[model samples]
Target: MSERQVARATLVVGLLALTVLVVVLVPRDVVPGGPVTPAPVATVLSADEVERAETFSRWARTWSWSSLALSIVVACWFGLTARGRRLVERVPGPWWVQVPLAVAALVLLGRLVTLPCAVALQRLRLDSGLSRQAWTGFATDQLTTQGVAIVSTSVAVLVVVGSARRWPRAWPAVSGSLLAALVVLGSFAYPLLVEPALNDFEPLPDGPLRTQVLRLADEEGVHVDDVLVADASRRTTTLNAYVSGLGSTRRVVVYDNLLDSASRAETLSVVAHELAHARHRDVLTGTLLGAAGALAATGLLGLVLAAARRRGAPGPGEPGIVPLGLALVAVGSFLVLPLDNAVSRQLETRADVDAVRATGDPAPFVSLQRRLAVRSLADPTPPALSQLWFASHPGVLVRVAIADRVRAVPG
Candidate 1:
């Protein structure tokens, strides 16, 4: 096949494989119990909580948009401007060293310019009583996050540089596969490596809750060995649960606060939601999508770089051009936010559906959704534009509405 045809076929096969994985991982039997029944919805929070939630949502949008604008401005400066290109030229080193340095400098520069907005958001969370972490802890967390970004960006740049140096004509093919592999590796390794660095995890104690969780997992066809709990209360009051890792590292994790505060029914609803993700092997599905996305992105990057070269821009292997590549990736990623969030919202909504099916009721699911919003001060009705591009899950009111429609279980 010609290279173009070959690239197209490879992309199609990779995406199909990911779709197959997603299909194979989910429990086919998971469905609405006795067809969803309508139930009366009652208030789950006090007037004070509702007021705080509204106030939080109001200014939160302003800060969030401000932060987004600043980040994009910085990305454009580093990617499109002569000044950013000059910064890289000022650094003296070999290609490998220079590329990593450029990646680091750009990453650091982005962080510096956006730090004020990040701090402002954190302050909002703390003041709103959502976060309990101290300033020192928050600052340390930021540094740690930046460190990870630097390492990840540096590795990606190095891979591109090496691939280009050795296989100029075939770099797109090789780098695409490599990027996909990197995404898969990170998905599998994140829980084991990166997550442990952020919080302590231990197996949930043997109790009625644990027994119920294990039983539910078995009922759902998920092979969960244990449920782990994170001490998330140390940082935030946000209640959450998730399934992470592939193979041996895979497990369901719940926030300790989830257990501490939620009723058995509410907690079980959360566990059921997480179990749906595990049953479907959502992590692997995500990895496959990541790989496919990488392939598509690498192909576009090739086209973009070629166009730049036609206009006398430095080639990929030339010194100080890594910033240009990083810039391309950043802008491309930013542009795809709406698409990403759409997929995420779909997955999340599916999990919500599964939880209702697994539990045979929707009251707890609805109640938990309400409490989550109140606890986190999430915006119930964010700007539609922002929700389309940025929200990873449906608005709380929407979730409650979905639950309210579920068929009431026979009394």
Candidate 2:
């Protein structure tokens, strides 16, 4: 063959390979598992279901976008408003004391601003039957979450600002290690300290389910002395399971609702998925990535604060920059959204794959995913931009297609 003909053939083959890669990565349709093409398009949702799902999706998107806007706006308002800055300064305390008090107030202010919309969102969930939580329980959870957030955030702010003031030129370097330690410490403490405040948990009673769970954990190479069950049925009817903590605290937790609602095969599939997360140390992986992101953020903060001070803005922990600092953090969060989601989606996709292989039956894997979406009122086709910025897991249809592809393969 001539050299030109050989080159053309190679190019054609390369294009075909690239096309296959795209097809493999994305599902061909909205149906769970894979395309039902050449068969008439299968209905995934009834008319009423579609209308309700759309309402839920619209409510969620509004809440998400509004929250983002409010965060930035609140930050800017505090940063610019002389009265707000003065209110923070009126509190008499040490820089440590002063910072915490101001931060607490600021946090409360943000919460108050967003609370109405939050309540509305909860009401929507309740009306849709997604949540079973009473208003009293909901209120208590909110107060608890706010209290925890204020305390943790105040400590973090102290650490960041103190490091900056103490080592102006090397603030990022000094704070990175401490912040990373805090991130890891927080991860380890969460199941013991924070989770119990929200929900009660107990060991899964001695039953066939427990036996199956332990067996799956063993097969997945994860140690599970006892699988714990959270009383999630009290707050939400959503079927779910998760793995949390590390070392001795490492355990698989399934919602009581999941056990009560899902079939034996479906339950096994969920357990296997959680075990995969623990076995692969996904939480630790996330914490490490979080630490890296903190370092980058701290570095950015240092550079910005330095520039601002040169232009006469207040130095660290001085109260004047408190609002600006919060605003900057909000912007940082917006900037990192894509990168964070990319990592999360990759991890979630792998866990889905692990669940399918561990179960060796893609049918339950596909069924469980569809059930979760239908139960949760998830958007059938979220916009691509939304997925890029916010989705932590692959779309349910994509996951189903993965199972379909796997089931098609001969052993």
Candidate 3:
């Protein structure tokens, strides 16, 4: 190739590199609007209750971090492979010619394969184990979150690729940085904004039975603002409950089917289980962990990209870099899925143990386990390998065994 051709090719490679960086690392997710505004009912909690809330927040943070770390690690690994690195080098083509080829490939792969797969997954209905009331809330939350992830990711990829091809080397960094920032902002925005909006639609609890549930939670040191009844039956027939929001807005949510279907003892057992999570402040704990993991993932990905760049990987106007980056993300998630689930399961087990201790009612807990098995139609004895590899929550048989032990204990 002529000298001019070689120079143009190298520049094109640089552009491709810039584009890949923006697409893979840029902050494109939605951002929470402004500061977290505590709700009106937040101040009624006692000092101990406030402490528990903080603990829950921390748990939530942890969960988020683990997922983030896994994603970054996988993404970076995919980005630095020989195929990806070779494309980043931009060997010898006119910059304009290379850009078109790269763009065409991106459109074909992303639109035809990646996007279609995501759409198919979204269309498939999964059973949500809850009453009709709780099921509605779960579906709403899941759909909202998944939609935001897909849209934001697509936008980030498009913006990065387009800008990298057009901009000069000196200016391309700006494109990459801006994309990265936007993604970060978006990630925080969606949850913070959507969570509050959903809270507004939250229905208030009625009837003496619900009131008693609230009273028990309170007596056991779970100072909740309101008990929100969700229609979770749409997702699955499983009995379940959760406590969410913060400050005065914090509420204990129970699925209606859980209350109706479970025996009185079983219902109390389930409530006690969820109440333990609330009292211990596991959500906050998970969130803190998640943030840490995300930061770590970002850092690891940057290192991988840097190493690839040193190998003369193609810049913008190249075909391989963008796909390679996305592939890395996919691989990383596959590896981390099991580990993240393990952490979550560990925390769940803790909540279960605490419930047994708190309620001192193993009979109800045992009953709760039986009902869970029947309603979810879960295998009473799932494979041990599956439990270790994929179980997010402990299996029914395992839970029942624990309850039985609790029952045998002398009060």
lDDT of each: 0.78, 0.75, 0.52
| Displacement of the residue 100 alpha carbon in candidate 3, Å | 20
Give the per-residue lDDT digits (tens) of candidate 1, residues 274-357.
Answer: 898887677777777788788777766766776787777777667556767877887788898987777777677778777887
lDDT assessment of candidate 1: 0.78
Ranking by lDDT: 1, 2, 3
Q: Give the TM-scores of the predictions, in the order they appear.
A: 0.90, 0.87, 0.57
On lDDT, the leading prediction is: 1
Q: Backbone clash tally for model 1? A: 7
| lDDT for each residue of candidate 2 in 1-411, tens digit (9 for 90 to 100) | 432233234334334543453344422332334442221113445566656777898898898688778877887788656655686778787777788888888888988998877888888889989999999999999999999988888878888778767765555656655776788888888888988898899999998988888888888888864588999999898899988886777778899999899999999998888887887788877776666556556655666776677777787647656777777887778877987787777777778777888999988987898788788887767788988998988777677766766666522
RMSD of every prediction: 3.5, 10.0, 14.9
How well does candidate 2 score on lDDT at residue 382?
A: 78
What's the candidate order when arranged by decreasing TM-score?
Answer: 1, 2, 3
Cα error of candidate 3 at position 395, Å: 1.2
lDDT of each residue in 1-411, candidate 3, tens digit only: 432333344445444544554344322311122212222222233355445434433443344445444445444543656754455345346544443444344333333333333333233223222233343565566556555555555554455445556653422343445554554454445434654544332454576667667777877898866666665554456677776554454566777667678776666666777777678666544544443344334334334444566677654334455655466556665676776676667667667666776677766776666556555444433446655665788665556555555455533
- Once fitted onto the true fold, the runs of candidate 1 whose alpha carbons sit more than 4 angstroms away are 1-48, 408-411
Q: Is candidate 2 or candidate 3 better by lDDT?
A: 2
TM-score of 3: 0.57
Q: Which structure is stronger by lDDT: 1 or 2?
A: 1
Worst 10 residues of 3 by lDDT: 29-38
